[model samples]
Target: MQILNVFLVIFLIVAAIMVERTKDLLSAVIIFTSYSLMMALLWLLLRAPDVAMTEAAIGAGITTNLFVVVISRTRRTEK
Candidate 1:
């Protein structure tokens, strides 16, 4: 349990950095979705199923889709 906690913390830190440092809008959105999934897992491990489900739905599902849509619409027309 303790080892898993430490690893989870490290993973979260790395994931957060990846999400922020990623330059491509599409890649950033994907990373953000993954980050949300990680957060949902952490919430589940903390025995908060409701919050986990909410995070999964709102953060991973809806928010990610919205981001993708926005990015797709705003994609630059490279000549």
Candidate 2:
């Protein structure tokens, strides 16, 4: 479990960096959503189901939808 936690942390960091470094807005938003889901999983692993669910609902669900909608309304690529 400890090793898994460490791996998850590493993955979260990488995903965050990817979100920042991507040249495409849509790709960045997708990576951010993935990062949020990973965070919810980490919360679950730490025995916080309520927080995990909240993160999943707010961060992964609504926020991702908003990002997608905004992306669809605007440009998909970043300058």
Candidate 3:
């Protein structure tokens, strides 16, 4: 469990960095969604189910959807 926690944290960090480094806006949004999901999972592992659910719902679901919609209505590539 401890090892899994460490791995998830590492993955979360990498995902966050990827989100920032990605040249494509859509790709960055997708990575951000993934990072949010990972955060929810980490919360679950830490025994905070309520926070996990909130994170999953708001961070991964609603926010991601909003970002995708906004991105689709604007542009796909970055400068």
Best by lDDT: 2
Displacement of the residue 13 alpha carbon in candidate 1, Å: 1.1
What global local distance difference test value does model 3 have? 0.93
lDDT of 1 at 76: 27
Q: How many residue pairs clash in each candidate?
A: 0, 0, 0
Candidate 1 vs 3: which has more lDDT: 3
For all candidates in order, the CA lDDT equals 0.84, 0.95, 0.93
Q: How much is the lDDT of residue 46 in candidate 2? A: 99
In model 2, state the lDDT of residue 64: 93
Give each model a TM-score. Answer: 0.88, 0.97, 0.96
Ranking of candidates on TM-score, top first:
2, 3, 1
Tens digit of per-residue lDDT, candidate 3, span 31-76:
9988999899999999999999999999999999999999989979
Q: Give the least accurate 10-residue stretch of model 1, judged by summed lDDT.
A: 70-79
Better of 1 and 3 by TM-score: 3
